[model samples]
Target: MKLWFARVAGVSASQMLMVAVAWQMYDLTNSAWDLGLVGLLQFAPSLLLTLPAGHLIDRLHRGRLLATCMAVQALCALALAGASAQGVATREALLAVSIVLGAVRAFQMPTQQALTPLLVPREVLPRALAFSSVGLQGAVIGAPALGGLLYALGAGVTYFVCTGLFAVAAALCLWLRYAHSAASSEPATWHTLLAGVRHVWHHKVVLGAISLDLFAVLFGGATALLPIFAKDILHVGPWGLGLLRSAPAVGALAMSLALTRWPVRRRTGHTLLAAVAVFGLAMLVFGLSTSFMLSMAALAVSGAADMVSVVIRQTLVQLETPDEMRGRVSAVNSVFIGASNQLGEFESGATAALMGPVGSVLLGGVGTLVVAALWLRLFPALAQRDALVQAGTAEPGGRARA
Candidate 1:
């Protein structure tokens, strides 16, 4: 419970910080390029530091590490607040802080993922993951609006609020108690750093699940073109664009709640593949729909389908991995997630430029469908797997569950 609240508050604080930072940057420079640079600078550190951070997570105490991350984020928020209050916040300062946040996130993400299985029994992990998604989706939906409201009061006020949230989250993390201990002390070397990559490469089920998300989202994402759809095709303006943006998260939150109530218990692999296929079908509907209502519905369905896939994939990965290696394996999984989202946006933009928006979306949808079909044949072990917890695997908490 402490972990759940910590995750919600931490995620909410992070989202609010992003909104305030982006608005502050735009207010100062009014340059789209500068805004894009902020995002790039933030992402760059994750690419460089995540693997090493994962190694440290395995060797150190995860809860303490997460608390430290939140503390650093709190300090960053305070710095931004101070700068905003002094009317001295600059583009350069924002860019540098973004790099710091990115680096902290590289550690925070894997620590959070690796810590969950330690806190919960393996039998309830699927439901716990589903419940966790509910909080995340809610924060993703609500925090930005809260930040915008707080920003109207002042950017300093928004930052102050974020600082408070981070502090509270850090306190919660510090309060958490779990049974798992850190891995045995090992010298940091190339072999240890690359273990995650090697593990993923050799574990065909993990490889299939993670890569499926990478390719599926890489081809099927249409978020980059939402503005185009709202203005030209739907004729709904900014208000409608906001709805389109929120629609998927709304669907995901609802689906997560359902999954928590009645978790997937059988044929988990086939279920994951079907969910991805449904997501493709939803994207296809969204691409072809002329009605705003239809488009909104399609996006909602896509979100719900994607939620199913997320719950299954995360549960599978956590259950398959031993406690000692969870941090490293989760780091590899996070990279796949980050790549799919970043590259998916780029793919959507590039294809939108070559073909029209509708055509690009249609192509992406078809491509996603084809990938789903191909993966069924490509990963037979995953497709035929019957249970989320294998018959005789050791759980992260160290007990073997049948």
Candidate 2:
């Protein structure tokens, strides 16, 4: 748990830097497209290196790999700080920093997910995941506001803070004493590397659950446009952007607390769909709202709705997957998650360029609803799942029971 908290702190700090950088980029170019570009650059590493990174995690000491990754992230943060201090934080330089940051996370995120099973007993992993997510949700609640305020002082100050937090996170990784699964003895070969891909491809229920999240969030996410909404749509400043960014986290945190106590134990499939549908509605409401309070409320509701799917999907992925392939499968899952989030930002930016921000957002919300409905038909086994634990007991490499 200490390790989890420390890593969460690092992730939160990185998120803070990201928020400030997005604000800075928009301030520099005053273009929503650039904000989207920042996300695209950050996620490119996931697209390019995550599969390999996942392979490495399975074949290496995940804790040590995480420590190395965190240290590298710190250097990237320090470099960004230097660039800002030198008055050389051009859009291109910032983008370059984002590319490095993205690559580091590409290696870090799967290892992080794979590490969870190592830290706790399998039976209680869902509960542990809920607690683990609290660190993230809490950080989301606080870090954006902190970053916004820090950036208000100076962008360099914000980057320096990130640098320190990442270094601390790196140091914490050294203290983890738990034993993780040993490296796979299989020789490093392309066939072995692609095993994780084949595993997901063959599992209909797992594929369905993952695909549901990928498409819904790919359309429903509106984070990349928050600065635009803060400045133009809501007439709020940087602090307001922070609040806008934090609203969903607040909702997610609250929901996480509730789930920690109750835990989603029944009819998880229906619940997942319902949560996603609510998320879409919230986005639609947020898109049309002129009032800041109303916009925040809508976003908060969306965030809360998103947590249900996150918890359920993550639990399903880890519980159903065999121990030997957790890293590779998680890498695949991260790719889907990264595409949905990063590419969603790009998609939002491109669409915002063609349509107005409000129009683009509205279209995305409607598209999210369409995806939920379509996925319901496309993966009926997933939709009919009754319990998170009992749903995927069959072979992960075989057909899903309908």
Candidate 3:
């Protein structure tokens, strides 16, 4: 629980900084393309380093790696805060901080995820994951809103608060304990580094789940263009932008809590597909709605739907992967997730430049729906999945038999 709390604080701080920086950028340039540039810079580190980072996670103390990453992130936040104090429109400096932040993410994601299972027993994992999801969703819901409020006071204040949050996270991480075998002794060879890539490629269910998110949310970058909506379309101030940014997280948090109360024990695959489709539909509604309240409602609904898939996909990937392979596999997973948000933002920006924000968002929604439908046919194994918890210690392909 201490670890979880620390993570929540750390993430909350990051989210606060994220919204503040994005808002600052949009305000400076008044361009959707520049907003996307923020996402792209954040994406760069993960794209370059995820594979190596995964190998390192499997070969290092995951807890230590995680703690170290948090500390670095705190430094990055501090740097951004320093920059922001100079002026609100510190786009160049904020963008530089993003590059550092991306490097932190590249190392942080897999280490954090791989460390999760080690914190609890196998039987307790699902519940733990559920609670973790709720915590994360809650952070998303509250942090952005808080950050927005802080931004209203001053952008520098928001950045400093974010720095403090990262410090708290790092401190808490020092106390969390776990037992593990010695780090992997394998040489960091090309073949060895690529092992995770091959593993996810061969695991049909894993591949399907990861790919679904990659495309679904990749196109779902409609959320990335939110500064435009808040400033221009909705005419909401920074506070409203924070609220708008947080809507999905609120829905996701509610859904996660419900799942925690009554876990999904059957038709896990079907649930994932249905949830993605619902998410797409909600996005479609969001794109079309003119009223601020209605738009928030649509985004909230979309977030609720997204939580279902996130839980299932995350649980399935972790449970199916071997202990030795978990870090690498998770690293592969991170790339997909990172790309979906950052690259997707870039895509949204490019398309928005051509077709306009509304058109871009609407098209992305349609694309998300199409991906869901196509996935139902493309991944028969994933589609046919039933249970989330395995019956015994079965390998990935043989889990059904177990």
Candidate 4:
């Protein structure tokens, strides 16, 4: 219960912080290229540190690590608040903070992912994950709208509110307790560092699941261009940007609640592919729509589709992995997630710079559709997968039975 609330507060704080940073960056330079740079900077540290961080997570107490990450984020928020108050908040400063966030998230994300399975029984994990998403999507829904309203007061105020939320989340994490295993004493080595990578490579279903998200979202993500749309294309202010950002989460929250009540039981693989296709279609709608309501509707549909994919992929990964390897496997999974999100933002920004925001988004939507089609051919194992958990599971070192 503490862990769940911690997730909600932590996610809310992070979303608010991101809203402020993206808006501030756009305000500073008014360049789509610079907006892309913000995402690139964040992704760089995660790219470098996430694998090693995953290894450490397997070796240490995960709850403590998560608390520490939250504390560090609080400090980051404080720093941003101070900068904004003193009128020294610049693009360079924002980029530097992005690096710190990336570094912290390298540990935070996989730790959070790895921690959940420990808290719930395997049989209930799918429902737990769906329930978890209920909180997350709620945070994602409300925080942006609140943050946008707060931004109207001032950026400094928004940062201070984020600081407070992080502090609260950190406190909650400190109270979290779970079963701990300290048995693995293997020394760090190249082979150990790459264990997660090798594990995913051997598990074709897992590989397909993660990589499908990577390429599909890499091409389909339009988040980086939201500021451009809010300002130039949609002609809505920060308030509207908040709503646009919240739109997807609104759909996601509703879908997550439904999933919690009635989880996906069959046709899991085909359902996953179809959800991605729906996400692509929604992106196309969002790219073409000039009406605010239409765009919101499209983003909402995309979010609902994404919620289905997330629940299935996360459940599949957690169920297949042993406890000892969960951190490392989740780390690899986080890398894929981070790539799809942070790197995707960079891709969106670069493409937007070249062809304009609408063109970039339209092209990405098409590319997402293409990737989904190609993946069905490329990973037949994933395509043919019948259940989230197979009847006969392989050992830790063997191929995952599909």
- TM-score for all models, in order of appearance: 0.85, 0.96, 0.96, 0.97
Task: Give the better candidate number (3 or 4) by TM-score.
Answer: 4
Writing each residue's lDDT as its tens digit, candidate 4 over 1-402 gives: 888899999999998898899999999999999888888888899989967998999988888889999999999999999999999999999999999999999999999988888877677778999999999999999999899889989899999999999999989888877777774889889998898888889999889999999998899999889999999989998899889999999999999999999998888889999999999999999999999999999999999999999998998888888778888888889989999999999999999999999999999999989988998999999988887756554223222111
Task: List the candidate 4 regions with Cα displacement exceeding 4 Å.
Answer: 392-402
Model 1, 281: alpha-carbon shift in Å?
3.2
RMSD versus native structure for model 2: 4.1
lDDT of 2 by residue, 1-402 (tens): 667777777878877887888888998899988888888987888789966887898888777888898899889889888988888888898888878888887888788877787666666778888888788899998999888888888889998999999888888886766655556788878887888889988987789888889988889899999999999999988889988999999999999998888899989889999999999999999999999999999999999999999999988888888867888989999888988898899888888988979998999999999999998999998899887877434232211111
Candidate 4 or 2, higher TM-score = 4
* Residue range 1-402, candidate 1, lDDT tens digits: 888999999988987787678667756875444654565566678778868988988988788899999999999999999999999999999989988987888898889999998877887888889999999889866776677677878889999999999999999998877764646778889999999889889989999999999889878877656656766789865446546766787789999999999888889889999999999999999999999999999998999999998998898889888878888888888777765664465567667767877988899999999999999999999898887766765487542121
TM-score of 2: 0.96
Query: Could you tell me which 10 consecutive residues in candidate 4 have the lowest summed lDDT?
Result: 393-402
lDDT of 4: 0.90
Ranking by TM-score: 4, 3, 2, 1
Full-model lDDT for every candidate: 0.83, 0.85, 0.85, 0.90
Each model's number of backbone clashes? 0, 0, 0, 0
Predicted structure 1: clash tally: 0
- List the candidates ranked by lDDT, beginning with the highest: 4, 2, 3, 1
Cα deviation of 58 in candidate 4 (Å)?
Answer: 0.4
